[model samples]
Target: MSDLHCPARILLVDQRPAGALAERLSRESLAATYDAPVDLDEVADRHRGETVLVVGPLPAEHAHAGGPVVLVEVDADGRRTSPWDVPR
Candidate 1:
């Protein structure tokens, strides 16, 4: 399917804690955000419906988790890039 209609929930994985990012994502009009530690397998199983996974400074282990995975590096500039960045 086209990227515009990707059917997957958005999962945000981070090692530095997901409080700040989750808050920001929740405030935005984007997809809902699920906060979890950097556990690929667990996160994958629990949120299997996830089509787009956003990782913050965490390794990209869920790349092969049966869907498109977006790796986002939380840089010092506070910039985060992910599949979600694509305009709706």
Candidate 2:
């Protein structure tokens, strides 16, 4: 909607099911999906040039994969947690 070209696909990796975020992303016209596997290497390989990875509260290791990675945190009330709030 913002004239931003959506990636071919978006991979959402979260510790818990991210139904809400996935729904929100879908509404934004971005092709999004979810995978809850313990290992991400395989998924990353399959989506090589077509996916933008979105990670939730997981280890940093799983946050960076391919394309542009977005780290999101949602509170119990479904409010998004700001990365700036994370103390250095």
State in Å the error of residue 39, model 1: 2.0
**Pairs with backbone N, CA or C atoms under 3 Å apart (clashes), candidate 1:** 8-51, 9-51
Q: Per-residue lDDT tens digits of candidate 1, residues 7-84?
A: 334445543324555454555453334444455444333443333344454454544332223533332233243543
lDDT (CA) per prediction: 0.41, 0.38
Write one digit per residue (lDDT tens) for candidate 2, span 1-88. Answer: 2212322333444543345554544445433345443344444334433444445544454355422234332222322222221111
Error of 1 at 53 (Å): 7.8
**In TM-score terms, which candidate is top?**
2
At residue 66, give the lDDT of candidate 2.
Answer: 29
Residue 73 error, candidate 2, Å = 18
Those runs of model 1 whose alpha carbons end farther than 4 Å from true positions after fitting are 1-10, 13-24, 27-37, 50-56, 60-82, 86-88
Instruction: Give per-model TM-scores.
Output: 0.30, 0.32
TM-score of 1: 0.30
TM-score, predicted candidate 2 vs. hidden true structure: 0.32
